[model samples]
Target: MAETIDDKIKNYRTAPFDARFPNVNQTRNCYQNYLDFHRCNKALAAKDQDVSPCEWYHRVYKSLCPISWVQKWDEQIENGSFAGKI
Candidate 1:
């Protein structure tokens, strides 16, 4: 296992196997990572902390989610119509 968060980030190639998302469908995994990316960024930014760690979630979601879906969700987030709380 990685010794630190930086190692985890550096080692990332695709979404790692998650016990919470064991099924074949990765839709939930993708969506959760998408939300996690935004939440991590927002929370860390508020504390004046580096937000680079959020990139892990961004990479994971980008790998698993459809581009069209990401676009739509991004648009909805901008328009305040996104259903998922970020």
Candidate 2:
């Protein structure tokens, strides 16, 4: 079965590396991810921009440094593959 939001959140929380910056330690990465996530959420929601949390999340996660998964995530989001899974 597909994973739920709770599952994703739990994974993110307990993940070995931070979602924001995957190369960094868990604590730092988690904090960074949280900040970026909130920032993206606010920007998208408040600014009425096409940018979604998924976009930022994906970019940061897949970046060469820290979190490179973000890019992979962006692809997923763009393709409607990561919907509700994040």
Candidate 3:
């Protein structure tokens, strides 16, 4: 049998293992997920598509990144100063 996106989402609990970030240090992974969430959301919204899929990135980052960092990055994004490309 095959799995669906809904199944994947429902099964998700926390950030999963990413081969790209093999080391114990997850700072890069956290930041990348944060950026991915916004970028995914933005792209879908721009296309008038459902943004639910972006929740995956949101959940991953929320589980990995610190609240303070998220807040600071959000502020920087709002002020057009965030260093990330998103």
CA RMSD of each candidate after superposition: 1.5, 12.6, 1.0
* Candidate number achieving the greatest TM-score relative to the actual structure: 3
Model 2 regions lying over 4 Å from their true place = 1-24, 51-86
Cα lDDT tens digits for candidate 2, 1-86: 89975566445532344344555345455445544664677677777776543544544433423444555555776797863333
Q: Which is the winner by TM-score between candidate 1 and candidate 3?
A: 3
**lDDT of residue 75 for candidate 3:** 97
Candidate maximizing lDDT: 3
TM-score attained by model 2: 0.34
- If both were scored by TM-score, which would come out higher, candidate 2 or candidate 3? 3
For residues 12-46, what per-residue lDDT tens digits would candidate 1 score against the true structure?
79888999999999999999999999999999999
By summed lDDT, which 10 consecutive residues of candidate 3 come out lowest? 1-10
Per-residue C-alpha lDDT of model 3 across residues 1-86, encoded as one tens digit per residue:
79998899899898899999999999999999999999999999999999999999998999999999999999999999999997
Candidate 3, RMSD to the unseen true structure = 1.0
